[model samples]
Target: MALFGFIGAGNMGLPLMKAAAATFGKNEVIFTDASKERSQFVSDQTGIRFLTDNCSVVKQCKNLVLAVKPQFFPVVLNEIKDVVTKDQIVISIAAGIKIESIKSMLSNSVRIVRAMPNTPAMVLQGMSGICFSEDTFTDEEKEIIDRFFKSFGKYEVFDERLMNAVVCANGSSPAYVYMFIEALADSVVSYGIPRDKAYELAAQTVLGSAALVLETGEHPGKLKDQVCSPGGTTIAAVKALEEYGFRNAIMKATDACYKKCEELSNK
Candidate 1:
């Protein structure tokens, strides 16, 4: 059997196909996309193979990754449910699709992993969160899937209830971070820095700051304090950010994102 099979080869799916190929080799990976040209593009880019249809992928592969967008899950699940076997592991990277919802379409006997992965995965720095249908996977199966995710970036397994929180935290937060970088670069440009240099400086600062948090395991507050010395420019900037309600704005944004995830789950 092929090691990894993808149901769609769009932006997120394409990178994941590459990661699976990196982990298991190209010959063991296969996929199918809605557009034949898209499927062919992925094949040419990664040297992976593609079949003509989703059920063909289900028949051939052991671990099936349903990488289609959330709206298409119902149709795609209906198409493959009949052909998917109990021995196959079906993993989904679509945001806001619940395990119970999938179990209703496919049988409870079918193994399902619901996951959310961000766009940074295109550059191999993606973070993913997963939740399994109860008692559905062996420890060995879990290990291989974990390795598959780590081939692109890091991953964490969470309780299914917290999966929406994962949506707001990492899955959608990159857009906010990118907006912050753009605003910071604009401010730098207003201060006479070249626009290209300003963007590079702002983006690198954000990247390094995130790296510090991940690498040091120190509280972000402590790191911020380190930068804001007594009567320093950093402290002055911090005071301005607080005055503008930066933290509150982020909290509100996350709350909205969480509510939207809940809405998607219900639909």
Candidate 2:
């Protein structure tokens, strides 16, 4: 049996298929995209077979990924609705589309997995959240989905209700983190450091700090304390950030993103 098939071969889908094929052999993967050139390009790079159409992908692969955007979902869903089977696992990456809605659109007995994966998955450092319905997935199926997600990076299983929250924390926050990196590098560059060197320093510091959090299992506050020597430069900068409402601004930004996720999910 083929390991997996992907219906969308855009940026995120291509990376996911690459990661999956890397973890689970390329010959077991099959896929197609709306754009035939891109579909063939991904298949060529990964050594996975490229099907002529989405229905062929569904008929041929046991595990199928629905990676099309929200706007394109209806058309794509209609195209393969006939071919998707009860025994097959259908995973949807579309933001805000609920599992129940998808199930209603297709066969009731189909196994469904809903997931929200961040942009970092492209670099094999993603944080993904998955939710499964009782009627749709067993514990074994959930484990399979979790393993598939972790092939790219970290993954956490959560209740379906929390999927939107995951979108805010991991999916939307990457852009915010990039903005922080750019701002930090700009500030350092203004102080005479070359822009490239400043960016390298800022990016590496953020990377290392995140790794520290994961490795040490320590609260970020304690880690911050460790970095701030008594009356040191780090303390001065921390004070400036506090004065500028940095923490409040970040909280508000995440809140805004969370609200947007809710709005999109309804759509």
Candidate 3:
């Protein structure tokens, strides 16, 4: 039996399986997807066993990750609820799905951990927010969950009530960041730089800027001030961004994301 099993092989599932394969041997990881072709592809690429059905994955693995979409949770959980044992630990990556909801789907005695991880996890630089049900997981079980999350990137354990906020801050912010990079590259390309070179420069600048923030632990506003001197080009561009409502746009976008998460959780 594989040590870990993933019930979906889509975008989030693929990356998560890859992360788990890093900690457990590839052969120790098993997965199943609704699409046989998708499952086979992941199996071929990662050398992990691909079970033909979701129940097989649940039965064969001790640690099960419910990597299916939020909408499909009901169907998938119904399929495995009969076989899932109290001894197994189930981790869910479906956004907005709470621990209580999962417990209701299966059995209240089942150990459940909810996690929100972003697309950056594909590159092993993901930020994850994880929360576990009260009085359910032992210290060793919690350690196992932490190790699984950290295998891909950093994780913070917080109250599940803050999960919607985490979704806006990290889960959905990657798309906003990508849009910013695209706009930056487009602006440079308009100035006669090659498109590819513009993208490379823009992306690297964002990467280095983020690294600076993490490494120096300095306020981003102070860093901006460091680059902006009196009568400077950086300040001029900053003023233009302010006039264009750049900051307000980001604020509104994240707010929209948070609200959407709340709506889903309510459903």
- Which 10-residue window in model 1 sums to the lowest lDDT? 131-140
Q: In order, what is each prediction's RMSD in angstroms?
A: 1.1, 1.7, 1.1
Tens digits of per-residue lDDT, candidate 3, 79-178, equal 9999999999898988888888898989998988888998999999999998887756778777777788998889998899998888888888999999
Residue 144's lDDT in candidate 2: 66
lDDT of 2: 0.86
Q: Go through the candidates in order and give each one's C-alpha lDDT.
A: 0.92, 0.86, 0.89
- Clashes per model (N, Cα, C within 3 A): 0, 0, 0
Q: C-alpha displacement of 218 in model 1, angstroms?
A: 0.9
Between candidates 1 and 2, name the one with more favorable lDDT: 1
lDDT of 3: 0.89
Off by over 4 Å in 1: none
Candidate 2 per-residue C-alpha lDDT over 140-234 given as tens digits, one digit per residue, 9 for 90 to 100: 76666777898999988889999888887887888989999999999988999999999999999999999999999999999999999998999
Error at 43, model 3, angstroms? 0.7
Tell me model 1's lDDT, rounded to 2 decimals: 0.92
TM, every model: 0.97, 0.93, 0.97
Question: C-alpha displacement of 206 in model 1, angstroms?
Answer: 1.0
